[model samples]
Every structure is written in C-alpha cells, then in structure tokens.
Target: MKTAALKTVDRRDGKLAMAHFYVAFIALALGGLAGLLQTLVRSGKFELPAGIGYYQILTVHGVVLGLVLTTFFIMGFQLAAVSKTSGTLTNRQRLIGWIGFWLMTAGTLMAAAMILLNKASVLYTFYAPLQAHALFYIGLTLVIVGSWLDGAAIIMAYARWRKANPGKPSPLLTFMSLVNTILWIVATIGVASTVLIQLLPWSLGLVDRVDVLVSRTLFWYFGHPLVYFWLLPAYMAWYVVIPKVIGGKIFSDSLARMSFILFLLFSIPVGFHHQLTEPGIDPAWKFLQVILTFLVIIPSLMTAFSLFATFESYGRSKGATGLFGWVKVLPWEDARFTVPFIGMLSFIPAGAGGIINASHQLNQVVHNTIWITGHFHLTLATAVILTFFGITYWLVPHLTGRTLTKALNKLAIIQAVFWAVGMTFMSGAMHAAGLLGAPRRSSYSEYGGAAQAAEWIPYQVAQAIGGSILFLGIILMLYIFINLAFFAPKGEEEFPVGETSEKAEKTPMVFENWKLWLGITVLLILFAYTIPFIDMIENAPIGSKGYKLW
Candidate 1:
C-alpha cells in the first residue's frame, strides 16, 4: 500500500520453489512406486522379504509425501503469495525467512532419510513403542520449529508494512497468511508435543506400549488441521488468482472470509472421523463427530458456491449464459482455469466419499479398504499438486524475470490434466475394489487362497496407466522447474503486470476490516472443533483390538 516499486521477492522462494519442485516429484515418485508394488503384492504378483519391509516402504512414502513434501511446498507458496499480495518489503526481512527454509529442508531431509532406513515404523503419525532412531524424532521436530520461524518472518514483514502505512487494510492474500499461520501453529501443537515429549522417549525404548488412542487422538488433532493446511492455500489460490485470470471478480469478499474462518474452526476438531474404523472410540462420540463433520461440509459447500459464483461472473463477461454455459468461455490456457479445473474436479469425488465416511454407518462399507486411500489421495493430490502447478508457473516469470516458453508452459498445463485424470480413474477404481473387500497397507494382495482375482485385473491396469500419466506429469514439472530455476534468462526489460498482481493495483478490493475477519475466524474454528471434541473426549466407548503383520 505504501510503494509502487513492486518487484518480485526472489528470496528462498525461487530457490525453495525449485528445490521443493524436486522434493514434490520425489515424494510422488516414491509413493507411486509403493502404490505399484502394493498393487502387485495385492494381486499376488509380488511378495515382500522377511521382516517389516512393506510397512517400512509404506511408512516412508506416507511421511515423505504426506508430511514433509506438502509442508515445504505449501510454505514456499505462502511466502510467494504473501510477497505478491501484500505490496510490502525490500528484502530486509526476506533474508531471515530464507534462512528458515534451509533449516526446514535439513530437518525434513533428516527425517525422510531415517524413515527410508526403517528407523521410524509408526508412519508419520509417529506412534510410540514403534521405536525409531532418535534422529528421526529430532529431524521431524526441527522441521516444525523451522516453520514457526518462517511464520514469524512473514508476520514481522507484514507488521512492518502496517506500521509504516496506518489504516491500510490487509489484502485478502495477506489475510490468508495471517489465518494460515494461526492455523499452522494451532494444528502442529499436537504433533510437536508428541515429537518432543511422548515420541522422543518412546523411540529410545523407555516405554513398552504407548496409548494408541492417545497417539491417534493427538495425531488426528493434527491430521484434520493438516487437511485445512493443504486446502486453504489451494483455495486461496483459487479465490485470489483464478477469477482474475478468467477476467472476473470474487463473488463476495465477505463470503471468502467466511469460508476461511469456518475452515480453521471445523477442520481441526472433526479429525476423529478418521478414527471411525478403530474400535476404542465410542459410537456416541463417533456419531457426534459425524454431525460436526456435516457442519464442516456446510462451510465447504459455501466455498463451492462462492467459487461457482466467481466463475459465472467471469463467464458472463465473456458473453455466455446458461446453467453451465459460462464454463466454456473460460481462458483454458491461463493458469487460473487450468489450476482451478484440476482442483475442482478432484474435490467432487473426494467430497462425496467424505460425506459417506463422515458417518458412523457409511464408514462401515468403506472402512479399512483401498476406498479410504483412494478418497484421500483424490482430495489431497488435487488440492496440493494442481495448485502447486499454478503457483510455480505464476512465480517463475517474476522470480526469474523470464517469461516461460509458451510451449513449455502449455506442456505443463496438459501434464496437469493427465495427472488429474489419471489419479482420478486410478483412485476411483481402488474405491470400488475396496468395497469388494480389498485391504490396505499390504505389499502383496494375493493370499494364495483359491479365490479368483479376475475382477481386479481391469482396475489394476487402469491404475497402472493412470500412474504412468502422473509419472509423466511429474517429470515434465521437474523439467520446467529446472529450466526456470537455473537456466531461464533474467530479462532486464519491463513487462506489463498481470491481473491479480496487487502491487500493480489491477484488482480493486470491495471490503477492508481486520477485527471483523479475525473474530469470524475464531468463531468458525470454535464451532468446527469443539462440538466434535465433546463427543470424543466424553462420549465415545472403548474396546481392545489389535492386528499383527504376517
């Protein structure tokens, strides 16, 4: 708000963005490998060696992709988005932020390496008594601590900007940074506590059997919140970037703020729905969580409503009118449509399955099946991968000062569609097969019994093909990132600013209020989290159950 000399903050973001590009691909590649191996194992095509090798691979894949890769990539996006949106800074505080990025990378690498080595068998959930090497716990903790430092840096820079120019309302993009950091701190508390206190000693063999529910409870506290952590940035990208790309305005500034606040509130508390398959949790509590889960969906639905509204407005301006006719007029080549298209497509399936599993009754049909896996990957993969695709492309020109080759950028977009469709078909089939009694977390699927595995043949082939598409997408993403990250020319010439560029004053704001948004955020989180908390803490029943690997 104070300066017109808007330039790209090519801090750790450009490097981290590129560095994280590698990390994202690695995580996806390994996870894909594991998924393929798992399919082979499930189909009786492959077998595991003696010992816990399958679990080790599964665990590493989970921790690497689920925790480390997503966190790093999301942080990179946040840094870039804030810098672009807030019209602030001159690299005074950015230097400090990049220092934090290296710390995060070191911690994540250390943890991932240990997991690959079979030192941590608890999954990223890091349950106790599943002793990992101490280094794993230390590495994990450092990653989280590093994030906190990064958060402080962003906040400090924003604070400085505010102090310099009073009464200037924070842009929605900057507002996202504020809420996201708050949610991050709130969510990570559970995992941070476990890593430092419960897990550190347990991994050292100081304890025999840790309370699995306690472990699960804390994990879910983080888990549900983690979902928001992933979704918010994507949603923000969708809100702030997508419409502008399509030549439209946000449906309502108030509606967008409402969605954010609701997400923070409900996302953290309703994690227990994940625990529905476990026996120790009581039915009453699970049901209550089911109710809270429903409540959470309402806000998400509002988000969907607002998103469609934004699109419709954009569509009409392009001279389209019909129930869904506006969809056709969109600039498909633009990062806005391409990114949101992938994201929206993924959410539909995920949300449908989510509603089913949110209930105690419906979860029974899908419980512990590949259906569960398919559903989550559909949700998370779309939300994180597609949006990251857009952010990278959007930032590349700014950071490198080189406009990406049109051909290469076009290839990236096509690759995204391939990944999205491939993941969808593959994951969708997994859900159907799961309903027919396929189990999860196994390296091999054939039990050597006489039962025919013919029905799964088509599904497996589809999944493999889909995996191939995703693999190609990742490869292309890496290639593009590498080119931009290192070799892309840094042009000295000035180019016209793109829409959604706040510093350029291209998009005008409709509302400006700090307390109003902050208060709404608090209220949403409270409503979302507390209702389910009551059901879980006080009402849920208990049972003793355990499963052992063969």
Candidate 2:
C-alpha cells in the first residue's frame, strides 16, 4: 500500500464513530457513579436511599459499564480503525451503522429504565431463577441484534476491500478489527440463543418455569468469552496503536494476525472454566475447558513478546545500550504511550489471577470470594478501561478535528496515574479480604458479629478510598473527552497507523484465509461444548418457577 493511501481520512466515518462513542461515554459516566455508591455502601460509610437498592445499583454498574459501555466503545473504535486503514465505508454501510446505533441506544434506555424501576435487578449476568421483566429481556435482545448489525457493516466494508484487491493482505488494523467483530458475533451466539429461545419466553409468561442449570450452562458458555470481547480492543491498542505512538512499527504483522485467529478459536469454548464449581456439568468437561482456557493464553503471551521486540528494536536503533535499556528509551512522555502502557502492565497480575480462577482445585478457594472481584477490577477496570482512556486521548480529537492542548495532555497523565493507584489499593484490599473469607456480591457489614468479619472492615474502607479516587479519575477523563470533542481548537492530526516492520508485500497468504480459521473456530467450539450441552439437555431437571428475591 502506498503511504499516501494509508493516510486516508474520512469525516463521515468519524461522525459514525463518534455517535457510538457519545452513547458509550454516557454509559460510562452513569455506571461509574454507581460504582462509587457501591464502594461507599460496602465500606459501611453509606446506606442506600429508600428507592434505590444495593442490587439495583450493582446491576446498573455491571450492565452499563461491563456490557453496554464496552460494546459501544469497541464498535466505535473498530469502525474508526477500519475506515482509516482500509477505506471509507459507503453510504449504505453508514446507514446500516446508524440504524444499529439507534437500536442499541433505544435498547440501552429501556434496560436502564427497567433496572432503575427495580423491575430488572437480576444483575448483569441475569442468571435464570432471578426473574426480571420481559421488557428487560427484550431490550437486551435488541442490543445484541443492534451490535450484530454494526459488526455486519464492518464486515461488509472489509469484504468489499478484499474483493477489490484480491490476494492482498488486509490492512493490519482492518484484519484485527474484523477478527474481533467475528469473535463477538460468534461468542454472542450462546447468549443470544439462550435469550431468544429461553429467557424471553420464560420472562413473558409463555413458560411458567425455566431450568436453572441449563440457563446457567448457556450463560457460562458466553460469560467467560465476554471478558475477551472487552479485552481484544484493548489488545488492538497494545498491538497497533501503541507501536505507532512510540514511533515504531509492529515487529511482525503475521504474528499479530495469528494471535487474533487463536483468540477467535480459543476464547469461546473456554467459557466452561467459569462453571468449574457448578455441578450439572461433569468434571471431565470442565477439565477439557480448563486446558482450552490455557491455550488462549498463548496468544496473549505472543502479543507481549511481539511488543517487547518492537520496543527493543526501536530502542537499539536510538542508541540504547542494554537488554533493559529499551524500557527507558520508549516515549514515556506521550500520554498515548504511557496510559496504555500502564494498562498493559496491569494485565500481568490479572491474567495470572485468571489462571487460578480456572484451576479446578484453586477455584474452590476463591470462587465466590471477593478475590474474583479483585481479579476482574485489574483486568477489565485497569487493563481494559485504562486503554480506552488512552485511545480517547487521540481518538476524540482525531474525530473532531481538534487540537489536544498541552495542558490537557498533562492532565491525562495524572488521570491515568490516579486510576492505577486507586485500583491497586481497592483490588489489594479485595484480595486480602477474600482470602480471609469475605463473600462477594453482598452488602454484609456485620458477619453476625464475627471477629473474622472485623478484619474485612478495614479493607473495605480502603476499597472506598480507592473507589473515590478511581471515580475522580473517570470524571476527569469525561471532562477531557467532552472538551476535546466540542471545545478544543480546530487542527489537523493524522490518524496513527503503525506500519509492519516487514510490510506485507510478500507475506504468507495462509494467515489471511478467514474461512479456514472460522471453520476451525466453529469446530473447536463444537468439540468442547457438544457433549456437555447434550448431557445437560438429556438429563435436564424440571424448570423452577422464577423468583423476585430483591
């Protein structure tokens, strides 16, 4: 590809991307407020008001931040990346994207209203037996369908590009974006199937009861991979965006493609790892999923190695002298580099904790404890959310044709630091308290006056402090983003597109074969899930009538 062509810019694409982002940030702000309230309540420093319950707040926090925010943001970012790297989307594609966006936004509003009204406080997972309003289920279904349409738009654009340039490797950003979208579409099947086939009817009174185990089984099938749906966009930054921000190229384009393919294949089938403690499924299947879970880790390790290699190569060329010297030579002053870099460092502990969670023996220790809570805060909150902040440092301005002021740039650095420090304190306390027998998803201040529970109080207080700081950080991020979008001076800034160190002029073509990888991904999902799903159905217990416990 010519350098000039690679620098393509399209305002139409930016508008569509920003539309998704606008909704995403709204979700972030509201959900983050709920997070603050959660910590306060847990710390025994605050109590819920008459109309607002703890679980209601928890449901909004999880759904808005975890599901709604991540989905919209990823779609926006992926669309933006594809347009810049590949080519502009046609008018029809833009129309489809807008339609999808409206559907998603409507769905979000419906779901939010239901949760706030205390009609759908079933929590984000919405596990069966905890019944919610039918509108809640229908709204969620619309969100899923909207996202599918959005993904389809991106895929269509890519397909057009491939048709125009037969045999050429798809641009790295486009390829990564496409793979992530496909992974999402495929991973969502588990949840969509359950929601459409079971939950909607059950909630609507078409079915008097629903099988608890079967519903849970279906949920876990989508639940674990849901984590990756959030992580991959962040990984795209670590792989593609960070390299460019630091003035280096990707170490190898082929390696990055391989990692994405591996994720597509391994991420879905490993959902059973989350159900290691559940009894309906046999231990044998759990073990198989555990092995598959470990397999998914390989791609992440590959990414770490590739990124280090890029840093080293750039560092040596700039006169750095030692194996570790590259660390100092990278662009530490750039918010675009440093913010996401902190996020990358966070994943080390988070990923290690995930291994423990997947372990059949070790999971018995921390399965329902706050330790799992700590683990995810590091992963999704720090590793994923921090990266999203970094992307916004440039992405918002890039879309709005605005200049990111030097003053605001420094503030961005402080924002990232606040998040890191706050998460460390909160997640640290969570881990310590959980190991001491603190349960998760509870509003327990007094453990029946047990002395052991007293130990957790101090940690809970620390969590409140950390939560406050993190809340402040998110508020700062929102202010900066809004300012960049509407108030900054107009300026020209190129979208950063990292070049392949050895460009794909003559790379192996096998890496670009989407059909081959997609086939294998489906096969692996079947291999891992078929027997267990069949068994669950054949010996399924009678469905239980739903309960409104809250």
Candidate 3:
C-alpha cells in the first residue's frame, strides 16, 4: 500500500479516538456545571435564574455525561485497540468508522439541544408517566443505531484481520474488541426495538396505552449493559495498558477474555436490579436479577486478581518481594499506572453503592440520594474519564509524531490523581449524608426545616471542595490538548513506553491459556443469565410491568 493510504487510515482512526476525547470532556464540563449547580442549590448558595430549569439541566447533564460521552469514548478506544492488534486497517473500513462517529455525534447534539431547550424534561431515565418530546426518543435511537454500525465495522475489521492471518489466536486487543462489539450488538437491540416498536409510536400518538412493562423491561435490558459498555474500555486499559506500562506481561490474557465474555452474558438479564426502587415490577423477577447482579462480583474479582497478579510479576522482575512491597516498586509516574490506580480506587465506593443499591433492603434508605450521584461520579471520573486522558497521553506522542512535554504530562497525571482523591473524600460524605436522609435534587438548603436533613450541610459543602479540586484537575488535563495543537516538538522521541507497541503486537498468555478460560466464561455467563430471563418474562403476567421508559 502507498504511504498516503496508510497515513489516511492512521489519521482517521487517531482523529476519531481524539474526537471521542473532545466530546467526552465537553460532556463532563456540562455535567460538572449541573453538578456544581446542584451542590450550590443544596448548599443554599445560588439558583438558576428563572427559566434555567433544574429538571432540564439535570436531564442534559445526565444524558450528556452518562450516555453520550461514555459511549463515544468506548467506540474510540475500540478503534485504537483494533488497529494496534490487527496490524493495519483497510481504507474503506476507516471511512465507515468516521461515518459512525458523525452519526452518533449528530444524534448526541440533537438530543442535548432538546435538553437545553427544555423540550425534553423527562430526566435521564425519563421513566414514563413523564414523557419527553418525540425527538428525544428518535435522537437516542439514532445514537444507538450509529453505535451498532460502529460495532459492525469493528466486527468486519476483526474478521478481515483473522482471514488474512490464520491459525493464530486472536491478539488480546482484537479479541476484546470482538467481545465488546458482540456485547453491544446484543445490548443495544433491546432499546432500539423498544424505541422503534413501542416508545416512538406512543410518543407519536399512534398507540394508546402501550404496555409500560414491556418498554421498561426492554429499555433496561439494554440500559444495564450500556453501563458495562461504557465501562469496557477502561477495563481494556486495565488488562492491556496497565501490564505493558509496568514492564510486565498480563497475568492471564485468558482471564481478561473470560471477564469480558462474562460481562456480555451476565449484563443482559441483570436489568431487574435497576428497577428495585420502582413499584409494579414482578417481585420474583427482581430477585432473579439481584441474584445474577451479585454474581458480577465473581468476574470483577477475577479482574482484580488478574491485574494484581500482573503487578506482582512486574514487582518480582524489578527485584521487589512480598505483598505490599510491590506497591511501591510499581512506577506511579507512568500515565498507565496513574490512570489505572485512580480507576481502581474510584471503584471502591462505586462497588459499595452498587451492592447496597442491589440489595433489596438497603436500597430504601438511600435510593436517589446525592449518594447515588456521588457513586457514579466516582465510577465515571475515576474509571473512564481519567483513563481516557491517560490513554490519550500514552498514545499522542506516537499518533502526532511529536514529542509530548514531560512537565505537562506529569501535571496531567497529578490532576488525575487529585481528581480521584477528591472523589474519595466527597463520595464518602455523600454516603453519610444519604443515610441521614439528605435529598438529592433540591435548590433550597432549608429541607423543609427538617433538622437532621439540615445537619447534612457540611458533606454537601465538602463535595464542592472536592469538585473544585476535580475541576482544576480537569483543566490541567485539558491543557494538554491545547498545548499539543499550539506547541510541541515536531518529531517523536524515544520514550519508556517503547515496549507497548511490541506488546500490543504480541501479548503472551503468561499463565493460563485463554481458550480454556473462554469456555469457562461462556458456562458461567449462561448459568448466570439463563434462569433470570425465564423468570422475568415467562413467569410474569402479560402487561405486569409497573413503570414505563420515557
């Protein structure tokens, strides 16, 4: 192939990855505005001027930050991982990727516009009985469809790479990309069907009294998996980027594959956990999802073990010994370690809230409180957002063929670490406040003169301090993109990450064979989700659902 054609493919993939970065950061900025406003409202500091509508801002913040930003970033990361593992991309395939990017981008913009104009006020969940404009449903469907197309492109590229290079176990990067794409294909179909067959028609008034249960079940069938979809890229970095940066091979490529496959199978029938707070869902169905929900810890724990083991090997190779000594030996200065560290730490509270929210009894105390927001913010901020920045800094020197400024890069890592630290203290406070019955969305600090409610004020104030640290950290991270565009050396320099490209090309299965783990993964997932689906739909009465998807 001509150098021009190769450069074309390279440039397209690189730009799309960065496109996701830009879009995600912008979304977070909006969410931060809403989040800060929410804090202020609770703190009794400031309120939106008249017509600035809290519900609308909340909805915008939620959808933009939660859905669009996360989705685009994953799509972007998939392209990067696939390109590295597959060796090269075909030109036609490259174009499809960009087209997918544009469609999702347009759909996201249209949906965000609806939120800003106050035409869509149904909140992010937009649970029915409350409806958003028809355009909201249509726009979201477009986003889903666009993502499906991106998944298809990835699937095709993986196949082509496989055909051209036979009998070799697929590279870990390509393998993970396939699993994510397949998961997305199965996952998004539910919401797409719900939107096309039920929600959209009802919104257009073509149907009267649409079965609320049907749409709600389908919407969440996709919804729960979407969270995993948002999360998979970070997990990818954990498996691939972390070990490479530590100068260690992954402990078990097979384990990583097993975890990804488990995610696909378990994530589907697990939607019922999300509905535990709402009324009208079949009680047995809820329990089934909950049971499966807890099972997720199995795969997650495996991931933790695998990453730690990888860290252990690196520590041993570097001549460190014992359980905790390895911790100090690992290079925290590396962006990969820094991002993964922040990501893993953030999951501590997120996992706790996830467990409480999943449990039938505990959820009642803090459902929909500021604690829930704190949990997800910790999850997103620590996991995907920081990792996205980390991965970008890791890749940019190679992509632009420019030597990145070491000082600014280190600053980015500092800011990211600080963001994670801030969320830790802040999210902990949110938990305490929630237990005290602090409300989630409110502009007035008065809390209707409920004294206990009023006592939670300090935690809310504490979150602003956390938020300020987080916001400044974001500024340092964002400065890199600006710095890159305006300044930076023209040629790539030798760097410590000299090993990543080699490893991406060939990641050895350090301990276990991926094929064996792959089989175990399939069995576990099948066991986890199989009965849940039957109990959810087959056992429940027709039209038995209580809530509707907006």
Top TM-score model: 2
lDDT (C-alpha, whole model) for all candidates: 0.68, 0.87, 0.70
RMSD of each: 5.1, 2.6, 4.6
Residue runs of model 1 more than 4 Å from their true location after superposition: 1-7, 10-37, 40-43, 46-52, 88-92, 279-282, 449-458, 489-550
In the range 1-550, model 2's lDDT, one tens digit per residue, is: 3324755358898999999999999998999999999999888778888879999999999999999999999999999988887788888988899889889988899999999999999988998889989888888888988999899889998888888888888888888899989988887888888888888888887877766777887787788888888999998998888888899888888888889888888999888788888887889889999999999889999999998988998898788987698788898888888999999999999999998988879998999899999998999999999999999889999999997888888999999999999999999999888898898877655465467777788989999999999999989999999998999889965577787886434557797787899889889988998998788777766545434211
In terms of lDDT, the best-performing candidate is 2
> lDDT per residue, candidate 3, 98-212, as tens digits?
7787888888888888888898877777666566678888889888888887787788887786666556566677777888877787778777887788777878876554655
Candidate 1: C-alpha lDDT: 0.68
TM match of model 3 to true structure: 0.87
lDDT of 2: 0.87
lDDT of 3 at 16: 63
Q: Pairing residues by index, what is the TM-score of model 1?
A: 0.85
Would you list the clashing residue pairs of candidate 3?
none
Clashes in model 2: which pairs?
A: none
For residue 343, model 2's alpha carbon misses the true position, in angstroms, by 0.1
**How much is 116 displaced in model 2, in angstroms?**
0.5
